[model samples]
Target: MQRMGGASASLVLFLLSFSAPAAPIPAGFVSWDVTFPGNSGSFDITNQTGPNASTFPDTTFPITTTLHLSGLGLTVHFANGSTVVEPSSYFTLSADGESFNGSPIAIGGTNPLPTSATLTGTFSPVFITLNNGTTQTILSSFSATISPSAGTTLADGDFAIINATTTTVTGTPEPGTWFLTVAGFGTLLGWRKKGLATFRNLLERKGAL
Candidate 1:
């Protein structure tokens, strides 16, 4: 009866060890380099943890992408600056004395990724929507590419939008660490059970003496 109780206690301890929660995800910035014709720069995507800000999505990182343009001829050359990327939405550009907005071009699949991208083409047919909600189609063109920093992916749904148009990226971890962790715990449990059995036998021999 004592040996059986000891074995059961050992099993409970093994199960309890595995029940501990995983490590917390640390806060970090996801940086990317955005480039355009005759201009290049970098930006960061980070969570908005400030007060008085809308937290509808609950979990979202704001990306502030900026560009410096000069060679592209417009009616009036405005100072180069950053464009506020609407979270999970679009961004705006200026050309020919007017502003045009577009969503990030999906590279790998249908979703927007944080991986590096090189856009080199005229974003033709960008229409300007009027105040009355009527869109006026115009001739437009743009080309640029973006690439993400280390330990990032273009397919992370929590950080990115993954779809058919999303581009594949390297450094994507496969067979995630969870599997390895569980396997390790399983092996440990087996060893612990054997050790406890040997301890029970030792105790029994001592009692008999």
Candidate 2:
């Protein structure tokens, strides 16, 4: 009877170890590098739309969506020895995945450039296709330039983006969640071993072993 009670307790403990719900994965940021062909300038872009992964738009075709930009940053390096930093701006993805119309992004509101400027233009054949529900391409062409404010000719020249590679963000489990998962498995294994030992001893004492 004592062995049976111990076995039952161990079983309960093992079950309880896995009772905690799994933690939700946290959202990540999307980023990409922009470079121009036969030019000495480049730029980088990073954007996060929401606090979680659920805010990402579905990449399915026949859909025209405007992704709201939150925490958007753009850094432009001009060939004329000038660099400009920009803030949050929005863009539109055409239904056919062929056009990328970027909204005017305000640049040079900070140091190094000091004067304000506007960056604007359109990219064509930005063809985006999905494979197994994953985005294959983001921006295929880039046609944009900076329109500097008065007395600021630092970043004033037509720029053509020759190459761009995008990286989509994926969610990951939190550190605490990983710890809990490991601890639970450890407790379950310990309880299982203890239960088996008790069962074996009980059988031995009862002349069944």
Candidate 3:
């Protein structure tokens, strides 16, 4: 009985180790280097410091092919000289998996982010490779300032201080992951207990325990 109790305790300790909190996501660029379906070459935006329109370097595509902007890193400043750096982890790839991941932040004076043809998210026009193998922006009737700061009025104001590169944000697993892990550990403990019981029974029959 005592041996079985010790075995059970050991199993509990092992499981507890895996349940410990994961480390926080590191601050800075997380890479997202991938090619889209229609691209002729690998669309490299490897180290974008999210601002303006980042485009693929070296690789040339047909003029009609539109290779718009990629990456998202924003810096918001306040009149008081305070700054907020948007973490890269806050974004995931767009649903189509081809556009920049867009997220909005609330700013001064009852500022709610606008959704219409406005400037709060995208900093520049989408770039298209021209038929001559040169790039041009399809200027939208509406574009907003990426540089937003505090004291900027809620109306006609830019809140994003700087548009910068985007990266992946690593985070901890959910409770469901822990639950599955514990279940696996329970199976291991059960097998160990069964093995111990069988050993004990054999020893008793041999008059050894």
Cα lDDT tens digits, model 2, 49-140, are 12212322542221122223233344555435675565444445434333323443333333243232333332222332222232222333
Stretches off by above 4 angstroms in model 1 are: 1-21, 24-28, 33-38, 45-209
lDDT score for candidate 1 against the true structure: 0.32
For candidate 3, write residues 41-94 as lDDT tens digits: 111121122222233451222223432333344344444455555554445555
What local lDDT score does residue 168 receive in model 2, on the 0 to 100 scale? Answer: 30
Question: Which runs of model 2 end up more than 4 angstroms from their true locations?
Answer: 1-172
Clashes of each: 23, 0, 15
By lDDT, the candidates rank as 3, 2, 1
TM-scores for all predictions: 0.21, 0.24, 0.25
Question: Candidate 2, TM-score vs. the true structure?
Answer: 0.24
Candidate achieving higher lDDT, 1 or 3: 3
TM-score of 1: 0.21
lDDT of 1 by residue, 1-209 (tens): 56456556555554444443322211122223233312322332332212212243432311111112212211111122222333312323424222233333333334333443332222222332222222233223332323333444322222212101111212222353345445556655766787778888999989953
